[model samples]
Target: MNKKKYQIFISSTYKDLITARNKAMETILGLYQFPIGMEMFSADDSEQWEVIKQTINLSDYYIILIGHRYGSLTQEGISYTEKEYDYAKECKIPILTFIQDRNVPTTTDEREQDPSMSIKLNNFIDKVSATKMCDFWKKPEELPGKIAIALVKAFTANPQIGWTRVKGEKLQAVSSELAETISENRKLREKIEELEKLLVTQKPVLSVSLNSNDPIELTVPTLPSPSKYPQLLRRDHIPAHLTPYITDYDITSYNNSLPSKEEFEEYNKNTRYYHLKKASIDFDISIKNDGKLKAKDIFVTIELPDFVEVQDKFDSYKNVLPKNPIPKSLLEKAKEKYIKDNNIKPKTSFGVTGGLVALGSIIKPYSLEFSSTYDDIIPHLTKSQSINSWSSVKDKTITINVKNLIHTRQKTFDDFVLLPLKAGSGFINISIICEEYDEAENYTFPINVSK
Candidate 1:
């Protein structure tokens, strides 16, 4: 009985995955299959590429190991390893891919340092992951076992015209058959190129996705302290109703608890009152144009909750009265004390009435009201500042990714001043509109606000 041996083309970033490549070769040999790669090809020679393509064409199956390094690129700006994979695909060779697990950090030598190259590699992986059945490997030792299993499955599911030994008289016939197969593969490549050209004229189809799992949440700001506050002030100690309106002076006057100025300041610093600190959320969006036509002027809008408000200095403060009403006699005595302390004339027509009104206003509790507007709710964001450039491209599909789009500082709805935060939480709708499409696609989700 004669055993068949298959030729497997192994492709990857050379230097970075050298050990991985060796393990793959050993696994292939263990299974009695021939492993071929760019090891013998000269680095600078142009003819080596043609040889590489010929080798890929002759191989029965294709296997690629994608790592951090993008490897060297050709004149077309595509990496040589990727080009080989494309050629194998064009030839209809059975392909298996083992990608380095991105979640696991690798050694510096095994990773790509350049940010641009890293983006390219990631894009390439996305393309491969989308198109074929691929496995992820974190270490070189893990690759050989995984690759052996994948190859076994691939062979069982899809068998190819593998190599078998021939006698002296059959050698000439084998050579002729090899030449015929090469000619057929060349014609197939030409046909694939023609189909690709036809596909270029199709209409633009855009695909957009928000990568985040949870909704965008806002962080509450700690209140300002007047330098002297209780060392351990629990949320319960600060009366919920009186909490928002508590001022530095209230600490000393309330219940005759005379806390020093330093304690108040410390308390103020640690409290969560109407501090101008604004809260923001980040968005990670990806847009893809799968058609031949380009997607122009893509715009994305994130809508904040209606309760999230922006306040300005000129905005009127809400009048919050005390929980308990003061007696008339006590009010009159307080008014007299205020006039005497400030040395204001008590005989004017507006007299104590104006002073009483001012006194009443001062005694009333006050806190910031978080609000939002149609315009301020959706802050002006730029594509360059918010979204990232395209990371991957395969056929007509191109992927554009945005790592971070921060919406932290927002102007108050009434005050129109920049504040570190605004407090409100509920369902918010985020929309992405593009000139390429007519209607705006909206993403509505719930956000829970917490400190």
Candidate 2:
């Protein structure tokens, strides 16, 4: 069987996963996605899903990053991840998944969230890894190394470029030794190219010619999730010996690892549109003159496309499908049932709504709503003050990710005064209530917390 060249289609929420997504894509495109901020890109680059779809369609591999809210649907009760995954499944693209930790919920009194590391991460392991699907890194610092590994695996499993067999690429042939030899990032590409060139020079026959008689398969088989995995995705054959390793299993702060797939379903009435609690993203905003506001732990918003209509059920083509921007979501439960019981694709269709919605943290790399420096500095704030909350779904946007949750009892803070959230196109009003009238009428001072 002659394998087709693989182009990875990165599916993720913009605000959350942008940095990581771009970082992953960097191995191939090299800053190609620089301007495509936290939301959907315009006609210039990723204007349509066509580019993503076409890449996945023509290629043999796929990468799905699982952030929090993996299975969230729009008002129409559709999950965007499900839609994209559905398409990937249709194309039979070989998928490798990376999942990150959702916020491990904590109570008000605690300084730390008890570091619920493995339990939260378990959802990821259950849904994503197998012989076919594998993990990306778990920590932010680890993403690049993990992505590099994924790219190597990708280049190996389907070693062909344009028409030639790209040498040094074979599944399972990429040992840690070869990975170690990759050495520094500066020389990485050059070294690989040199190695490939040398191999071609030494063994002229190392390269093979493509033929028309090759059997074109959709996706190669993926390794199955562990039996004890939280959510059992499509169960494929995994070696029995591998089972021993899967038990008690082992999750420590090890090397880089991606989380597993996550999901949600419907218990609502109409099923067309489901109601949701707004995600309140709590963040601390320290304002100074625009040189660089050290907004610690700033969060990104992952809103449904405004154009996406929330209905009781999935929208049929005519009633739902948009000519361009397909931004609709579908109920994962319904799709899973359809696949299990009826074997069909989602009937609902939508175009991407407003700007771009993002998930995953700065680790995934998307729009920079705050200073990129904030990303590198967040871990040092041991005070554990900033927070994010998800409120009700409003106008396609999950309003008030409320990234900063710190309250100040002091009337006068340092130059780092938190200002009123600016009113803009997205807001109804910016309510700045001065709790007590100042004798000097000083607007610069921090007002008392409004009752």
Candidate 3:
């Protein structure tokens, strides 16, 4: 068995991130691969660059770990680390970049001492971030896990031509076998030619019959009642008021003629109603295969147009009376008497004030009942959460398969509530993308919308 190992070049600022570089080397070694770094070269060494280029050329992958320092620069003023990265990129080596997390606080000693060096390091970091997909790590311990994932993904996506060794005896045997197979194949071809000359062949006449189905007429139906068919309330047809009920007091003030506790409980239960109109779109798709051979992986893509906008529902008030009614006559008279007497600003007498207080006490219970009803309606109103299920998606794409060459499929995407944006003669442009057919299958049709 021949085992292949990938040589990965690890380039980064050396001194400041010795710990991170060591961790990376450990990760590559643990994966049973080679890790090349700048450990052998001294600071500001220009002679070793040729050797570094040779190493990068031989490497299968390149990984760089960036830190605060830009490292020693060459005569050209470009850092040696950046020069190595440029060479690796020029050689088309697969590069994985790991950057130090900016959020992580670093000690002053750990960063570049020179301000210019710090600027160069930042510029280098920016270049790497923009050009390649990078990962940020705060600690050296995080390097192993992240590096492992990135290396695995890179190797899987673009596998390198790694070294492999074979036994001399096996190679000789394969060569001998290949020669014998070639000679045998040549003789077999000659025999096949002789046999073909001796055989007689004839072509058969093929007959074809044509049958057609009657034209299909698709009619758009009017919108149906929402109460009758709630499932049809999908898309634009879905009422904005999804809540089943809203109390009458919520819609209006109940200061004067407050209903009795029983009457308030029943009559103010739900006042909101949602009306629905028929939202139906019908269209036909025809598939024709002119070729004699059958096609596989046959598919059709249907792009539905922006049919309608979600609109408010038509509503009407329905009087829902409570079973046990509280006669309004007594409450009405009390309220009327209070209003009449309050017209005159009387003197501040305890007896007169107490009399007025008594009148309020009479109407206070009904007021409490009305307030209680408001509290009770809160839970029910909260439960009436609105969901616009159909409005979320702009269009639908369907892929289908038909058994025969000539086929017509009648497709109806019904129960989808459509609130036509415009009234009368609206065009729905359907885009059809067929995998098998070469010609364009797209078409446009008109729809009439009424509220």
Candidate 4:
């Protein structure tokens, strides 16, 4: 296989950082890639800007170098360097920015002398730095190493369609093989037509079993318990010890501290803990080839009734939580309640000169540990040689493509299907279609579901 070479476009001010641009180009060339720049084109020419955009469009990556002085401005008052950067971004090209360190020493000629130009340079620097990660370069000697590393990282992270060389003889060889294949296919079709005329009707030998039997027993999944979710519980459950100290003020405060009904309902609906707490069961489906001849291109589709739902074993709640389980707002509210109940006066210290305040001892708020227990069941669905792929659910039907099954071979998909059924009774219909038989094999299983 031929290795792909990426074309990187270098954008920078010509007068101030010409040496830096050249170094960047050499770095890309050293990596066995192509480097594109505007050294050949006139910077002030209007026609050249269009060509520059076209070149940038063709580039796989973009590298921009920023120094003390902004490059020559276009008719829109934006620098040519900034214009190229903007165009590259509009084209969706991966860009690497290198801005010169402000603390670095430079000659007067290298820095922008005009106040207005200096402001524009600062604004441009701020724009690039605020948007993306930029490397700071104090010297032109640092360009090659920084450019090489950033380019390598970009190449790995955001790969693009790069250039590859192809030989003309390869195309000709492929054409010859295609012609030979066509001729062989024509002869095989004639033989198949003659064999079809003498063949008799045959029945499919593939058999499907749910849990190694016809009818599958399904049950409604149990809903999550309210006790497991303390957030949804009533907040009026006060401790017996605090009853003597409880006042009407405290009762009113506790009542107002409860989360809004809407917020509570939303949290209950969205939290992964609540969703995963519901218990689910997985059932296995086994397919066997009972014929002497092999079965090819086998497809098994199971049509489920409205009372039952089929889910993948891997399906579960995918919500990502923060490192800290407790919200800061809740913690703050708890701290305020603790301070109010203890009657602790928070003291503030003023400095001698009245310019600053002294730090006070930190208040360690009372801690309450919260935890919940629920069953998290994940079925083991192992890969089988007879199974190819499972199509997405459509119209309550799941289509599973089975690999070529040899004679008398049986493959079991362990815990491959989950039937979360409603409280009702129904029949699941299964159809198996293969190339070895003239008709599709059909089977039906009665299911009784209950809570």
In the range 1-451, model 2's lDDT, one tens digit per residue, is 2243345567665555666777766754532211112135432343455665665566545667665544334334334554566677787666667766545442343112334533433543564555465664555456667766666666676553433344464633656557766666648788899987775444211111111213211111222222222223221322332333332222221111323333112212112221110111122222111111112222222233222222211111112111111112222222243344543333333322122122111132222333455555455433322333333334433222233323221111111111121121221111111112122111221111110
**lDDT per residue as tens, model 3, 1-451:** 1167889999987778889999999998888888988668875666788888898999999999988778888887888889898888899988899999877877886788898998988888888887554899999999999999898888788889865555699888888999999999999999998776544221111111111222212223443322111121123332233222223342233233344555544433321111122232223234444433443334344343343432212111111222323333333344345546556333343335423333443433422433445445444421111231111223444334333232222222221234343345444444433334455355544544553
Per-residue CA lDDT of model 1 for 1-451, tens digit only, reads 2287889999887888889999999999988889988777865678988899889889988999988888877888888888888888899998898888788877788778889888888888988897556888888999888988998888878888988888787998899999999999999999999987776555355544443344455566665433323243333455343344444454445435435666555445434333433332333444555555655565544444554433322321221211212113323444556556666554433335443444443442333233333235435422233333323323322233333222221111111222334466676455655554568776666765665
lDDT of 4 by residue, 24-113 (tens): 988989999999898678878999988998999999998899999997789999899899988988999988999999989999978999
Alpha carbon deviation, residue 355, candidate 4 (Å): 99
Could you estimate the TM-score for every candidate?
A: 0.38, 0.27, 0.37, 0.38
Of 1 and 3, which scores higher on TM-score? 1
Worst 10 residues of 1 by lDDT: 409-418
Residue 4 lDDT in candidate 2: 39
Best by lDDT: 4
Candidate 2 runs further than 4 Å off? 1-6, 30-52, 71-76, 102-126, 160-451
Model 2 gets an lDDT of: 0.37
Off by over 4 Å in 1: 168-451
Question: Which candidate do you rate higher for TM-score, 2 or 3?
Answer: 3
